[model samples]
Target: MASESPACNICESIISQTIQTDDRKEIQIARHTVNEHFDRLQRELLKELQIIENDKRKEISKILAPVERKEKEIDGLQISLAIIKQHASDLQTFLVSKQIEHELIDTDNLIQSIQNNSELSGVIVSLQTIGMMKSLGNISRFGQTSQSDMSLVRQKIKQAQAKVAVVTKGSLDHQHGTIKTEEGL
Candidate 1:
């Protein structure tokens, strides 16, 4: 019995070491899985954000095209008016002046229409990440590790049965004492 004590302690130490080694491997695998998932998620998010930025930029460019054309038209009209004033007769100047006035009014109306439509005013691009942010904030850990008591119980029962068998054999061979089972019978 005294010699069995060291053997039991050695068995327990081996079991503990094996469990710790298995736990370390499982933990490393979990860490790698978590990192891979996050890396994939980050790539997907950045791709989505880049696509949104490009789309918004295209929309803004579309909105600015007509305004830019109108600005050039206005500049051309002003240059033409200055040229006509310096180089044309009164009658020609008057006729061109009337045409220039109508063009200016049309340009003003177009600008007003653009303003009323709110095309430029309402061009807003924003990321809606409140839910994602909240979810991230709520995450306490990547994963959980748990030990089941059923396996431990089964192992202890097997160990106890083996000890009982050894004691039974010793008693039968040496006839030293009676074997005491768990029931104390």
Candidate 2:
């Protein structure tokens, strides 16, 4: 079929040129015609896509409104829940602080009782004197051991606190860090 198509004649000619295609202008015209058709097809496809995209945008807007409203509702609920949680944490801290206050009152009473007792004070002094004498005897030999023991304890505390720091700070931001345990220990 392609071979059967007739060639067009152009104006200029080479010595050996045929009547069908004699010059560069004719070749350029043919190429331009094919390219124009291809360009037109591409433009039609793009226009079709644009129409489809506009329809999709309208459809999507209709569908998305309810989803957007539901998302806002969910966000509102989350914010409310966060506020409630914050209040609960605040109340918990208040309760703990109140409990600590009660325990501190008990501790103060006990400490006051001890301080007011003359007999207890004498016993404390004698115990301290005996402890001092014993420690003085071991001080030269056990000084390094005692220092190392203190260092080890501090190191353990530092490591533990490092691990606890994040949790502690976050909790404190949400609540409080006042002492709440019983005072005896």
Candidate 3:
């Protein structure tokens, strides 16, 4: 058999010390027990490390959950803003069209108003004369002196006489019974 590995100094000393009072192999057996205890402690430390790692993972997931939700919410909000912008643009276009339509209507109304007020073709004037000749006696004759409404009739005749004597061509000649075919200007 191969020569047995020489014992380490500390093991040799433990062997000698224990051998003095106990069995010769008690030191080696006690050393084996210590190694077993160390292995148990190492296993316990590894288990504790695994527990710590699991707790850290749980905590990290908890911290990340809200972050993920907020990120998704931010993305959703951005999309909403983009859609709203399109709607806003459409609304702007609608308002502009309405404004243009209003302007067109206003322009048409203004043109109609301008056309109606031209300073021509205005000749007749009718006056209300309800109680003009109430005290007069009734007279049904045309050009009568005692007519019931003689005052109103006289005023309207005077106004018509003034409007017709405007001398658009010339004044009327004072020829007695002059016919138009026989007259020369």
Worst 10 residues of 2 by lDDT: 4-13
lDDT ranking of the models: 1, 3, 2
lDDT of 2 by residue, 1-185 (tens): 12211221111122225433444556677678869987997798778777776876776566556556655655665555566657778776565556555555655565566458632332211113587578667855311211124445445545655667778878886553333333333
TM-score of 2: 0.34
- Writing each residue's lDDT as its tens digit, candidate 1 over 100-142 gives 7887888788779878988667555566889988998999877
Task: Please identify model 1 stretches exceeding 4 Å from their true place.
Answer: 3-10, 141-185
Per-residue accuracy of model 3 over 1-185 as CA lDDT, tens digit each: 12222343344456456555554356567668869987997798778777776876776566556556655655665555566657778776566556555555655554465458642223333433456445233534323122244446445555555566555324555343365646755
Give per-model TM-scores.
Answer: 0.64, 0.34, 0.32
When 1 and 2 are scored with lDDT, the better candidate is 1
Span of 10 residues, lowest total lDDT, candidate 1: 174-183
Best by lDDT: 1
Predict model 3's lDDT versus the native: 0.55
Query: Which model is ahead, 1 or 3, in terms of lDDT?
Result: 1
